[model samples]
Target chain A: MNAAVEIDVKSEAEAFLIAEARLLDAGRFDEWLALFAEDGFYWVPAAPGQSDPLNHLSILYEDKSVLGMRVRRLGHPRVYSAQPAPRTAHLVGNVTAAPGAEPGVDCEVRSTVMMAEYRPGQAADRRLWAGQQTHKLRRTPEGWRIVLKRVDLIDCDAVHGILAVPI
Target chain B: MPDSIAPDALRRLVLPDRVHRSLYTDPAIFDLEMTRIFGRCWLFLAHESQIRAPGDFVRARLGREDVIVVRARDGRIRALVNRCTHRGAQVCQAERGNTAGFACPYHAWTFGLDGALNSVPHRQSLPPDFDLKDPRLALAAVPRVESYRGFVFGSLAPGGESLVEHLGPIAAVIDNVVDRAPDGEIEQAGGVARQEYRGNWKLHHENANDTLHPGFVHESSVSAARGDPRDYAAPAYDGHQTHTQMLSNGFGVREWQSLSLTGFPAGHSYMGGFYRGGVLSPDRDDPVWREYRARLVARHGEEKTARVLGEDRFNNLLYPNVSINAQYQQIRVVTPLAVDRTRVTAFCFRLKGAPEALFHRAVRFLTNLSSPASMILSDDIEIFERVQGGLANSEPEWLDQSRGLGADRTEAGGRTVSAGLSELPHRAQYAAWLRYMTAAA
Candidate 1:
């Protein structure tokens, strides 16, 4: 009852990440939320290479509760900032996996990505947003889940415009 | 519409109760403000902690000039224009770092931490008549730079009010923030939350003291925090609460009545709505608050510290650029990029000698209340952007600021007192704006 199954960890991981990006880019937040482990972390460090979020400030640091609340706000019609939502796109690649930090998981997925965001922004009427991202993922029994996703912006120190949406 | 900014024409844009929309969207008006307002006023640079070590430097901007705020080898802080005297190229490109000195990338002309010309590359190329001691030869220093406690500020005008004189009543907020620290000092903690908005810089400046829209704009957040976020039928907080919570609004005949809007001379104002006994109560078993309060009692004694700790000031706008929340240990700086674009950077401070818990709590408050994820900030930015968009149109030529006109009463100490939700802050700011816009250069 067993067929030869060739499991390419990198390919699966890449597919998982591409699917995750698709969910986000399409504004399918609820589906994206399902891709996170129960205690997953969505962190955008305030300082470059910042280690801890509790002690230091973060642009976005959310546990399940906070992430849920933000998602809820994003969906609310009266969410003023969301009336005309900031649109974004993600391009994920360089996928690699290592042993998972959790006991009963396959491995952690690491990747390099470039994302562009726009909210009617312009310097000379040019719409743009750019950043690099790192994601730490784990493979569960059913599907891959994100444990930690870190976004490092080129202008991390510069004043930001409407990071209200997920980066 | 005449192109000239004559005294009468400038004054007409700003009335006692309303302001012309062009004032918020005109590039000409923005350029004039760069000269008459920002150039003449004391603008915040960086906290002392930013440049605590000798040779540590952080870049800053005043009006549109790029500046480097550095702590010199002698431990004195200095601000120097980034323009190279040789070819006018920027001498330093980094935002902040520890560096021995800066050397222009274009040419090797170097300057010391104190901004003196340390050396020039290929000095033999220069003529023998060059006078190194000439004031114009070295880095062009800002006309006036001063520090109060740990906050540093700089002014571009050759002659104007002293930093302290310019601070006026707004000075008290800084003092209280530093004085409340158990060690009588505070240090910048965590990183800054840098937010950019598509709106006039003045909108963020005025929003600090504009307390009327919270109930309407932040309605979603209130319900989310307390009830179901999707509870569309839920009414806004309406500044009402249970009997116990009513006391928090202060003398709560009406929530608005509980707040006292005060305006001061030279364009400064505050919205006082902080509950009595302060946002942090000493009675709580919270370890950080307990320890913090004990230290205050030990140094300042019980009775005095109580009033100091129980200070009721909520939002303090230090005219032109900075908004401070001493109670929550926050300092927000607003930078104007263009007529309709601005950036706001916020920092949370740690009260020295307090537990790390206090630092965490401060960070938590900032995250929930002002971080980019915050609905409060989002709503405010949305409104600001909408206002900016609306002002770009000519249909509504004037922004109605007559919310509480003819209701201001002169109080002592150059203060104009008004009831709740009055347009006192806008009035106060416009008065100063007109004076500066019309003053002789």
Candidate 2:
């Protein structure tokens, strides 16, 4: 690929990541869900070097269906964890991309995301979650849909308090 | 017991069918519990499979004392106090690994797998009277360490009940878990998922066998799952088991009351299987279940396999710390961190000789139920913290555990059976708590 085309791929990936962060920040989980392909998954591994979500435990390993349940639960009125829904600001940076190995794929986009979550109360709970995200993109006629989005938190193996909102 | 907490005063905190809120809120009481209850109890440490080979070790907590559970070269498992005997620095820092010996970071005081002081940085600098062979110089070993069916437990108290006596009839629960394995063995698979909650450790145990709270506490996930429009008919559908498991929590009042709840005097308790229709149902006739059943039958024969597979119980709480779910092959170990904080570490087991897919399912179950981000446990933890927050007020000095009190009946064994929604488990826990708190020091 020429320099202009390479620059275009990088810019496109950066734009997609920024837009996705905005959707999460705005609590537009439905729109975020739409960004995932039908066969796509969202994984947050518990261990740093965890490879297999099937055989290993993870903080989260949700396919679209499970992620749908999560989204629904987040919206449910009785969801106590989200009673005072946590406000999150996802800051994306350090963008890098590589061409997909398989056919019918665009590129694999990698970035660093630091999500600042604040649960409102007299004694508010504020947490800064920093993680590396790997998003495999597929260039469809409509747009780039995510095939896999993996987040490896800095404290992947640490004993975590309730993660009310996604990082 | 601590000087601040008298035996009589501690005894008063736990009555026949209620306990004082201070038991959950007072830091002094929490300190007493670390010694009187946790110090004396046979707390579940680690599974044998985790330290199968010599030199393999895992870090564990016995009350507030950190210890290294290591298998020595001689094939003996020892729980060594992680502190260096010299300067009290932690000897081992890693969570789990294979190490020949532990070297203190502060001073290179090496301790063997058996916690024997093997070497000092500079022996020549020590006084002539400083004996290296002195027992005081070695890392302290837990007073007693024992294993039952690959489940290792350590007791800080020097001597009390034998491992069998401590387990009482609950030993059968461990047997049921091991016997479910096709090759009559199970290994700890998948990594551990640790979650911290702002509540007393006892809250986790009390809620483990409480059937009535699920409908109210997990209404969010249950209702969401009920409203889910996604198709679940696909064979081997991914994540459907979690959906069904969440739905199981929506059991009706009558249905929750119908299931059996049994509590032992030792504080151990369990509830009869409630997942009757879901993919998590032990009797589900699916490919994975069918394959697992075949493997069990191959080893134990038809009748034995039927007996093994037929046995179904959930959240088998073994007193102060551990809760086991044999059917799902998971265990959650509770560790008290402070008066109002606790940590729970969950691990999944792979049934030997069974299909790998079954283990994968177990992994999924562990994640969905215990992970930090779990939809179910997040609610439970929130309630625990809320309960702690509510207990901060002194208006209601006592909390009730009297549900199904008069209705409970004693069965053939030492077990007390009651309706599924009964708070007998909590009462039984406090009964044991009172006994431990007031016992002669």
Candidate 3:
């Protein structure tokens, strides 16, 4: 195994992730877009330890353009499913930076997050979603930008009802 | 009728044009269904790929009875009731796994992969005449287990008819899915989306082949995707309009064109959205789809391949519980929990030996269709729940189903064909239900 990563390398990545979760929780999606590198991906694997996104099914698998479309749709006034949006509170912990896998990457931060959501409706149902998250960041000219963010949910194997908003 | 349900009243509840609400809301009927319908039918066990190796297993429930399908040391597949002989506790808890044998955590009772009793807590504690060889002392195997083209099925009933015969013409639905793979094999090897709906299970069965609700229920999602809202301001038509103009037009998919419904014996049917067209494919320009078509042409030749790939069907139902969408590479099944609760699982199948993108497309369909997270399917789920809630009003005793009746023409092998927005599939299902309820098992 590789030696423990430097604290400087680890802290910046940790801060970026915590701030990213805050952005999502606050619904500041416009600023959230700026945090990503030109080439970035958001993915949620369907199976445990699923390596091939191309061959396997995932709850959400999107490249940059698809992500743009999804963000646009989430903002659409007429989008029925996201009408009265569900709000999420994220608890992100265990942030640690791993050696970069990309040729020109800054660092990869691996963290675990427990998200509880409340969707506004007659029933006002509450759901708890817990998952492991990984973010690959690149040092852009402006600052560090996300190259990838992957969420591996514990119950991704179980059937989920409508996922109205982004996870 | 309000006090108690006589066995004879089951037939009266299912009138040609409508069915009574009690059929959905009654706890007694649900219990009877567990025995008369689900117990006798050839229920799906496991895909052959899921249990490819010896000691491989997948656990599923047949009705409320927990069952496990396992591949044994002898390379044979078998299903056994999961209740341990010692105390009726479930023997296995994991959904799917590989193990040489099952060890019950309750009492340490172990059984071979084929469900033969292997060990007990202490031999000396047993009575002198106690025999380990009794089948009851071991895990009880299903009365009959059969597989057709690698699709395993098991029946709780002792014996009556063969599995293939039970499937009848609906077996073609399975053939359609497997044959679409350039190679003759398909894998439901991808992930399954399991979801629960707070509605009666029959709602999904009826909705699986429903061509009536797409334009109304899914209009908003369609507008977001296709940017067309031609009929958005139109007054909603009153309930019960037969021979109505095609509502599927607003959905903006080729498969949502002129409807074609064909019903078969044993409640099997396939519903196509178009009378005639190329298959509902939007990826003619994609390199992945092109390569996939070429492989099909090479395997099934030009004419037959085009014929095979050109049907514009939406969904195909296989009798009591399963629904297959060959176009989307999905096999949907339901497990009813209570009179008002049901769980739906959609199995996504990938075509073997095709380009990886082909599998990716299949995954997209399986993800986009059905399940709670689906942009398209949640519309139906909401309505199903509404129906379950509405039945409590007690004003209308029957829900209307009299669409495209008297227009069906009988075809070969007890199959019937009908035109746009036919309710013949629902009739066919109830016909099978009637037979099962009254039959002398």
List native contact recovery per candidate, as a fraction of 1: 0.61, 0.84, 0.45
How high is the TM-score of chain B in model 3? 0.90
Off by over 4 Å in 2: B236-239, B277-279
Error of 1 at B289 (Å): 1.5
Q: If candidate 3 were superposed on the true structure by all CA atoms, what would the RMSD be? A: 6.8
Chain B TM-score for all candidates, comma-separated: 0.91, 0.97, 0.90
DockQ of each: 0.42, 0.80, 0.27
Residue A155 Cα positional deviation in candidate 3, in Å, after optimal superposition: 2.5
Candidate scoring better on DockQ of 1 and 3: 1
Ranked candidates (TM-score, high to low): 2, 1, 3
**TM-score of decoy 2:** 0.97
Per-residue C-alpha lDDT of model 3 across residues B346-392, encoded as one tens digit per residue: 77777777787667666666655653566566667767866887887
Docking class of 3: acceptable
lDDT of 1 by residue, B157-177 (tens): 888779899888788889888
Question: Rank order by lDDT, top first?
Answer: 2, 1, 3
- Tens digit per residue, CA lDDT, model 2, A43-74: 99999878888999999988887788888888
Q: Which wins on DockQ, candidate 1 or candidate 2? A: 2
Q: Using lDDT as the measure, which candidate wins?
A: 2
Tens digit of lDDT per residue, candidate 2, span B1-441? 475767887777788778999999999889988988888899999999999999999999999989889999999999999899888888887999999799988979888888888888778989989887899999999989999989999999888889899999888889998999888899998999998888999999999889889999999899888988756667534538878878888888988898888888888998885654343585666787888888888899999888877777888999889999888899999999999999999998999998888888899999899888999999999889889989999988999988888988888766789888899889888887888887776
Model 3, residue B119: distance off in Å is: 3.1
Model 3 residue B71 lDDT score: 92
